[model samples]
Target: MPATIPFKRSEMKRLAEFAKREGVRAEIEVNGFVFRVAPDFNPVRVAVTEESDLDHALAEFDRKHGYS
Candidate 1:
């Protein structure tokens, strides 16, 4: 059996914008199919060694979020 789902253009545009701003992927399920929108670039991986700014930032975030 096939299903039909109604999706609005404005809603799709908003979802794409949200995904871009958040630098993450967004997905929607339509009629048993999944559609995805993601930022069009590969993220650069930073090597965070001891005393690096990124390491410090991550440590701060973990502490703030009670993950430390």
Candidate 2:
């Protein structure tokens, strides 16, 4: 069995415009000491806070699975 996924150009454009208006430009800031890191699209940066959070989550997941 298969399902069809429709791609609407107009819808995409509208969504992009909306994102731009909402300041949805791809960006990340990873300053270890800074709390206000702007987002990046080209060669985006990953904020330290985000990385730390993800690291903690992964550690917890691994621990649950008895991963050393």
Candidate 3:
């Protein structure tokens, strides 16, 4: 089994508000584990590539595995 951590809706709202107000990171520690909380400043966007890139990647995979 895996360990899980849960937060109440009110706690999540308060944390978000605190982060927004302070404009800094907020951290929480539980059972000796520490976590840093912050809003995603620059979320990664999926890149769109040409179809040739996919063909090349598939060819490379096939070559590496000797797939005929």
Per-candidate TM equals: 0.49, 0.39, 0.43
Top candidate when judged by lDDT against the true structure: 1
Candidate 2's error at 56, in angstroms? Answer: 0.3
lDDT of 2 at 16: 62
Total backbone clashes of model 1?
0
lDDT of 1 by residue, 8-63 (tens): 77878898999999999998887777768998887776666644987889999999
Which lDDT values do the candidates have, in the order given?
0.82, 0.60, 0.75
> After superposing candidate 1, which stretches have Cα over 4 Å from the reference?
1-5, 42-68
Question: Per TM-score, what order, best first?
Answer: 1, 3, 2
Judging by lDDT, tell me the better candidate of 2 and 3: 3
For candidate 3, write residues 1-68 as lDDT tens digits: 97776555577678877886787789777787665667657766655675678888999999999996
Model 1 TM-score is: 0.49
Mind giving the per-residue lDDT tens digits that candidate 2 earns over 1-68? Answer: 75333434565566566666676653322333212222334776999999999999999999999999
Q: Report model 3's TM-score to 2 decimal places.
A: 0.43
Cα lDDT over the full model 3: 0.75
lDDT of 1 at 2: 60
